[model samples]
Target chain A: MRPFSFTKIDNAANALAAKKEKSQFIAGGTNLVDLMKKNIAQPEQVLDVTTALSSEIEDFTKGIRIGAMARNSALTTNAIVLEKYPLVSKAVLAGASPQIRNMASTAGNLLQRTRCPYFYDVTTACNKRKPNSGCSALEGENRMSAVIGYSEQCVAVHPSDLCVALAALDAKVNIENSKNKKSVISFGDFHRLPGNEPNRDNNLPENALITSVEIPSNGFQKHSAYLKIRDRDSYAFALVSVAAALELQGTRIVAARLASGGVAHKPWRWYDAEAFLKGKEATAANFSEAANIAVQDLKPLAHNGFKKEMLQGAIATALQQCLTV
Target chain B: MSKESTYSRRAFLKASGAFVMLASIPYSLKAMYVDVDKLTVVPKQALSITVSINKKSYSVPADTRTTLLDLLREELHLTGAKKGCDHGQCGACTVHVDGERVLSCLTLSAMIQGKEVTTIEGLADGEKLHPMQQAFIECDGFQCGYCTPGQIMSAVACVKEGHTGSVAEIKEFMSGNLCRCGAYNGIVQSIQKVANA
Candidate 1:
């Protein structure tokens, strides 16, 4: 790794001041440190934000507020988060391993980079890493690349299961800037698709930092879960995962919030599937119908053609699990 | 059991303590300490750290780039935390900080200036072993024992976090700590032993 200066800051102003000098903000450093070692992320200075920001868990009038620095392990085990939002808990649990969840924060989990090997390998021409360099995953091993919400410039899958759950549940992020000013952005727009620019991820300014995530007040009473299908049992990223939350009014479906990961550049909201599930009886046929709507207009690469079917199966399984409520 | 393997309890305790010291401490500090002739410790520049470990206080100066794992093993002589993968991909350097389990390898020593940390070495009493430690031993949860500390730390947190509802739940929750020796069945059984208890 290249030699660099490290500074610890305890406030937003200090972190932004360091950022002005081109220092990268380090929260959990789960992703930043790995990239730094690989020489992919070479910042001249590192600003440790773990000391600056304070994470909290509180009840919001609208819902719950999860501090950005709160670890995934803490969130998964918190009584409120577990009881009120099983979807979030399950999503958190389905993520990386125990130690990772312990060190990984909610904000960091949301900002974790794609799992595309091309992006990690400095030798590969990945547009996500270097714009206009072109995505090698398009022609190379693309099994885990995006099958939906993809652009020609990049097809990398968003590797975070928590983001998919948050997007499906309509969570919102609260961000603070250098001036200590705050604003809220929907989780749907929190992560952007690979447009002309793949490097430009969330609509976050250079000096802006995430503070907390607020999942909207909803009745997720029982029907919700995050189903991640992977090659191995542990320490593996998802091949295809579905985050679904269903609302039941007797036997008919009152509402549905569905989002997919490991198959999209961003957390993908299946609006068509959600729209099709309204007022329909929760059944095998309805789930299959919703699955068809979810995969509409999907364009899979040669190696990831299996993902399309895998994604469909995952969605079916997740929706069926939701029906049990 | 083999006759040669029947070691006495006193011999077992002495051997375990030595193993703990070797596993946790850096090679530089492995030398015996002299009583009267005190060794003058040259403090590193521009560093003043006070971090709590296993509910005890410690004050040590560390390099800016030093990771918590390195600081524990090299500087403070608390070496139970293993450095399996320095890249945070492996959980061999797992420990508890402020009642939360964390990866010491990914964490910089400077970042945890005022937090409580707990390593496997601190988990046992003067003569009594922590329940999780005892369970791991009884269940044969480790082979080479490199990843045992991390596995045990994660297991303690797993039970405290209520991830012990079912076998699948425990497996899913504890999946982060990898065992390259393929002692997962024993590892899970060890955690289950404590969780059930």
Candidate 2:
């Protein structure tokens, strides 16, 4: 890590005002510090914004507004989250370990960089790490890389389990901008698809700080499941994860929200599949067909061709799990 | 935990928060800090901070890049927290910051000002061992013992966090600390013993 000046952020407005060129905000430091250790991120100035942000999880009649600085641990155990948004709660618990979940903030989790081994190794040529240097994962170890929404520049997938659930639930991100004005961006628009600019992860505005995430009321509360398929049962990144939420009447599906992680650059949602499942019988055959539609356009790499089948089975199983609940 | 019960000159000097006082301190006092200067002139970044470790206050001049794990093991001479992996992938450097278990390897030393840090060395009451520590010995919860400190610290917090309702629950909650020697059976037994008691 290079020598850098540190500034203690006093508030959201001052934190934005204090931003200079090559200045990165440090909240949990779970990912940023690791990047710094590997020299992947060398910010000239480090801003500590943990105290400047609120950590409240406000639950209202409309829905839940989770403060950006709220720790992942709090989301797992909070009564409101567990009762009303179990899909989100389960996704948070399924991601990192208890210690990491305790320290990592919600906003930091949303802004997590890909866990591509090539990106971590500074010696390797990674386009995401260095612009136009090269994409190591394109021909390297890409079993965990994206199968869709990837370009020649980068194939790394977004690595947030909470994001998968939030994407499915139609969440909105409230941004505290540099002008001290508030703007809300939809979850889908918040993250980029790694097209021409793989180096840029999200669509965050200039000097923008995420204040909270607003999740509106949805009727999938009773039937929602977050299924993560990983090598280990716990404390491991997902091979493929499915967040299935269904608004069902008896054995008939009224509405559905299906999205997946580890399959694309962003949380890959199957709006077509969701539309196909509407008003249909909530059976294995329908769910299987929906899963097939979800994977129709997936372009898997050599090492991860089996991920298509794995994801197909996972999506079907996750939808079935939601029904059983 | 008390911010008032500190008389250590190192702690007091940092608490004073004046560069002139640091310059006036004796030669012996000058030797106690890590780097007591500026960042622009020198090629190093250092900050004077006051932190509490094992219920003792410390006023030290720390490098801005020093992690809490390095600060504990190198500067403060608290070797209970081991660094199996400096990255957050492994939990060998687990410690309680403000009573919540967090990975010390990722926590910056400058971020810990005015916060209570409890390492494995602070778990016992004087000569008497903590209940979890005593249980680990009875159940033979470790072989190499490299990850024992982290495991015990996480286990203690697991029980306090009400995550010990079952053996499966205990295993899930203690999944952060990895014992490469496959001592999970005994580690789980030790947690069970302490939780049940």
Candidate 3:
């Protein structure tokens, strides 16, 4: 890793000031440090934002607010999160191992880069690493690449399990810019599709800092599950994961939210499938139809063709788990 | 001034001169100046940080690129924590910071300044081993013992967090720490022993 300067900031203002000087924010250092060692990320300066930001998980008027610096492990057992947004807790636990969950912050997890092996190898030409450099995974080993929202330039997938649940919960991201001005971005608009600018992972500005994520109160708490299908039983990235939350009235679904991971650049939400499930009976046939609709428009790559079927199975399994609970 | 002080000043000047000359050369040849003390050719600047480790405080100058794993083993000579994978994939570099288990290899030394870090070395009371350590030995929870320190550290946290409800739960929580020797059965037994007690 190349040598760099480290600045520890104690407030948001200082953090924003440090960012204006071509510095990357460091929180938890789980993903950023790994990328730095691989020579994929060589920031001239790293601004320590762990101390600068708030780490509280508090209740808002109609929802809960999770501080950007809150550790992933803390959220798994958080009283408010586990009670109100159980899917969020399930997704957090399903993701990384215990050690990584302890170190990785909530905001850092959202800003995590792709785990593409080719992107980590500096010798390889990756468009995400170098614009227009050509993506090696396009014709190389791409079993983990995105099956949707992919372009000729890049086929990488965003690797955040928590974000998938956030997408299903209709969470909002609170961001502060370098000018000290704040804005709220809906969760769906947070991550970007890997079009021409796969290098640009999200829609946040260069000097913006994520403050917290807000999840509005919902009735999906009693019937929600995060199902992650990986090659191994645990401590692995999802091959095809589903975050399903259902609001039921007797045997009928009053409302539903579903999002997918490992099949798209961003958390792929099937609004059509969600709409179709509303008012439908909570049965395996209905769930299977909705699952089929979720993957209807997918265009899988050569190695990841299996994901087309895997996504359907995962969605169905997640919905079944939600209903049984 | 003493004679020793004067000699040290001259040595510092010589090293600075050599650094200036070597900085202009290509990075590939910068290794030639590795023998120079007090002044080494680094691509980026160094920062001085004070870190608390195992109830002791250390003030040292570290390269911004240095990780907590490297600082503990290479600088402080605390080789108990192993680095199975420098990346966070493997859990061999697990340690507790502020009472939470985290990956030391991914943690920058600068990030843990003024924070309490408890490694495997700090788990016991002098000659007395921690309960988790005793359980591991009694249950034969390891074979090659490469990942024992990390496993023991994580097992302690798992029992504290109340995740050891059953053997399956123990296996899920301890999945982060990988033992290539397939000592998972014994590892689960050790965690169960601690949790049950």
Model 2 — TM-score against the truth? 0.91
Off by over 4 Å in 1: B1-46, B54-57
Give iRMSD, candidate 1: 5.6
What's the lDDT for all of these models? 0.84, 0.91, 0.91
The true-versus-predicted C-alpha distance at residue B182 of model 2, in Å, is 0.9
TM-score of each: 0.85, 0.91, 0.91
Docking class of 2: acceptable
In candidate 3, stretches whose alpha carbon ends up further than 4 angstroms from where it belongs are: B1-43
lDDT per residue for candidate 3 within B1-197, as digits (tens), equals 77788679779999999999877797756564564531443476777879899999999888888899999999899999998988988789999998888889999998998999999999999999999999999999999999999999999999998999987888899889999999998899999999989
**Model 3, span A243-322: residue lDDT tens:** 99999999899999999889888998999999999999999999999999989999988899999898899999999999
Looking at candidate 1, what is the lDDT of residue A73?
74
Clashes by residue pair, model 2: none
lDDT of 3: 0.91
Q: Mind giving the per-residue lDDT tens digits that candidate 1 earns over B17-118?
A: 999977998654655444222343323334667898888888986666678899999998887899898887778998988877888888877778888889
Residue A76 accuracy (lDDT) in model 1: 75
DockQ of the candidate models in sequence: 0.23, 0.38, 0.48
